[model samples]
Target: MRAHHLALLFLAACGSDKDPFAGGADAPPREDGGVIGDGSTTVDAAPRMCAAKPSRVVVLGDSITACSVIGGPNTADCVSKKVADYVMAQHGATAYQNHAVGGAKLSGIAAQLNAIQPAPGPALVILYIGGNDLSPFIFQSDQQAMQGYQMIEPMLVSVYAAVFAKLKNTTTFPDGAVLLTNTQYSPFDDCTASPYNLSATKTGLLHKFNNKVKSIADAQGADAIVVDQHPAYLGHGHHYNVTMCPHYAAGQTPWMQDTIHANVAGNVGLAAVMNGGVDRLYRDCIQ
Candidate 1:
């Protein structure tokens, strides 16, 4: 949440191999390139049977996935749980893990990835990040600010590429995996109550970021899928009105907690979009 926390996370990532959750240097090798067990070198004599479809789903991100409301207690209504429920219903996936921490940035992804246990079959890894990175530039107007954002864009792409490379090299998902990343939707853009008045610039930057995400995913091939959340949230409303907080009209509830995080309704909507994306990807896999 703070700069100090980010610094610590980055320092930990520098030695990601040491992370206990990750397959560290001491992790037992898979018998036949299969899943690694918990610190046990003894391999199962028989090959473990894998499911017909992906049986596991892991979510990694910041507050959106963490879903701790500012005033409310942490609830199961968050996006990660919703997504897990959707996947379980649609794909029969029984195992789900959420590694999302509030206020996390792309720099924190390595530790999150390290926390995942390798799956024998293909798994769905949902990654929703970068919103916090864009937060610092939400209100900048100067040319210098524009230049700074421009510089950060490529760096974000490079970070994502590096994470993907690690997943490919270290994790053993024999049937193949789907790395689903998302473009953030601005809840503060056009909101009358928001302090940051640079809606147009902010929106433009979000689109630019989204475009880069798409480009990077394409470069990563079919294994990477970018779930575009920008359009889905935009279709619901243009201005985010916090005063009309938790705006509920005709069964439509507000999708944001403050200016950035999503509320219960918002998480459900996001899960729906994610569900659609996963459905499409799964269909392609079977085909």
Candidate 2:
């Protein structure tokens, strides 16, 4: 490979600010298969011959999907943008759309899905939500919080089932589409600072939510993919703190923008996780 081609690969892998999503104009097309954002080549190694790639990619969720904190001139650093770019690069996708609102919750997902203008061809939908739904209980008393959390599980399960059902019933795709769901990861869970406690109850609820997401994916069968983000963000950095306290650790190099949202580096981390999930789908389902 030439130096410039190597450079493009690096940028794509890093989810850098540069035009990582630009059409693969400079580099020659891969005969084997294109690499994912994490720099992993496809396992099949044979050109995709089975399933048709998506014509459009759609992201649905809350502020996390909106890239609310990671905004800047380099919009490509956002997680949705990174995923869109990856699909375009790897699958020849032409369009990417995100319908994530800043404060969306699981209950509101149906409306988001309803609002989507279905594409004429196959569309990949990425769903990253439930953080807002659980955020309210983060600081509640253990007993009360656990009760609330317990109630949330059924709601989450129902909402996810409905969302998947809607996709399966309503969308019109020549080749078929896939739905990718994600587990929530909060840097605040790792923060040791006062008032930013990661209580045992909170931790337990987080695990439950993640398991719920996995269960939904399992129940949905091949079309649903779960991108586990909790493990990926663990130990990456401290949650961002607006009030400077001498005792509190500052945000790590590139993981967090605030107590809630991820910085550009954190967005890159998320993109990498999503990329891994997409690659798995290609190897196991598409191929």
Candidate 3:
């Protein structure tokens, strides 16, 4: 988090009202001898092939990673089943874990990361967050809504900064790209009566925020892969599958609306973006 919010939110609790990221929960020391929470490591090498041996991939994000509402990643009938299936298709020895949980606000990301296993082999850490932080706890009135956004932005941004800093020079995945990305948002119903429904503004804000995160990645010298989910996430009016939900109505799925959350088709599309997208972060990017 930015230094100020770090001071306020650092004590007492990290997530779910408990001091989730307590010490000792930190990832084990790296073979590289780097310290945690200090931004010193920088991977200047180009992308390399996955390890010759079998590999374990770990995704740390919010509901998207955990495959929430949907099952966690490869769990039976989970939305992330699609994601896992695609990854497994290419790499037969691939084993992966999803640490994402829904409602995992900024505070929650730090908590979960502490508990996650460090990257095992040829690791690719996919991190997509900041949406829920951008989302407010439903406000009762317009004035309250404005106040909430004002108060939350810095807190959220600072948290975003600290979380980014910790992971940017990550001791985990010492051999691979630590891909930093933000959530993909499509259209959401406008708030006609409440400023609380500022979905579009939030959408606009994501671009700005992602750029800021990109800056952090640059500071640490890692890949800042931009996996824009907006275009593909488009539906009739621009809404997505409710975060972790899979039961889109006949009219809401990608097939139905062209932009709800990924039906099997949409999921595959996202996988494609992720696959080639990060190549730019570490390898090459065309103008």
Candidate 4:
């Protein structure tokens, strides 16, 4: 790790909270007095059956999805694992597989995806790569950053296209599958600070990259959805103030373990977002 990254890691501390995935008749109600809604909602017009519900969940990405944190990483504490567990519990999935590797880039994810073979039943593939691919641009000059993004842009499109195609192939998902892709979040939240002073240019490129993801997902049709982690995590970074972003309340504690990796609580929030995406898919009755 770089000196600045190490310093940020040293500053990080982990915190705990009640499991957000717990639900059902025995589940506790929310502090707000509303019954906590599990991914399985009971509202009318909500489709009770979804063919997209996976028999297994597969994860792909770098350290974030791998649950790497400031301290030693825990596979069970990461977002992907949490989401996988939720799927198994709520959707009757029998298994979960995670192929994520710490520090893996897009190319690494491509390899991981390619290695996966056709399996019985529908599977949900949760992809959360590309953050590492964009991390170095944060420290680059404006010209260099722009140049780097330009070079990576086409690769992003091509790689994602190939990945989605294979994911939807009948041989890969014999029964069927859902692709739940993620957008990267900013740990600095547009507020530049000491050590990895995030720049507007870097942030812009981040959105651009996410937009490319959104577009690709959109083109992939209803079975593919983009879990917009960026906006969902807006107020949980270094500038964890509602005043920083209109998306959430101000003055929230940072959910990050370091400059990039999310802490345990942050992973819970991410899992919630992932679950919510599936909830919507269930609502829409996506097969």
* TM-score to native of every candidate shown: 0.71, 0.73, 0.56, 0.76
Off by over 4 Å in 4: 1-51, 70-75, 193-197, 241-251, 283-287
Model 3 stretches with alpha carbons more than 4 Å out: 1-54, 75-81, 84-93, 137-146, 155-177, 189-221, 236-265, 279-287
Clashes of each: 0, 0, 8, 1
Question: Candidate 4's C-alpha lDDT?
Answer: 0.62
**Cα lDDT computed for each candidate against the true fold:** 0.56, 0.60, 0.43, 0.62
Question: For model 3, where is the 10-residue window of minimal lDDT?
Answer: 1-10
Task: Using TM-score as the measure, name the better of candidate 1 and candidate 2.
Answer: 2
How much does candidate 3 score in TM-score?
0.56
Name the best candidate (by TM-score).
4
Local error of candidate 4 at residue 85 (angstroms): 1.0
Off by over 4 Å in 2: 1-51, 72-74, 170-175, 189-195, 239-254, 283-286
Q: What ranking emerges by TM-score with the best candidate at the front?
A: 4, 2, 1, 3
The sequence of per-residue lDDT tens digits that candidate 3 reaches over residues 14-99 is: 12221222112232322221111111112222332322222554566665555553445776444345445544565442766677
Query: Per-residue lDDT tens digits of candidate 2, residues 1-287?
Result: 01110111111011212221122332334343322223244422444333346788888887778776667312887899998898889877798878887677778898888777756777788987776665554445555555565556566667877776667654544446778777666464334445654444445545655555564564454566667676666655463443343223355354766555677888888888888767665543345
| Candidate 2 lDDT score at position 61 | 81
State each model's C-alpha RMSD to the native. 12.6, 13.4, 11.7, 11.1
Q: Write the candidate numbers in order of decreasing lDDT.
A: 4, 2, 1, 3
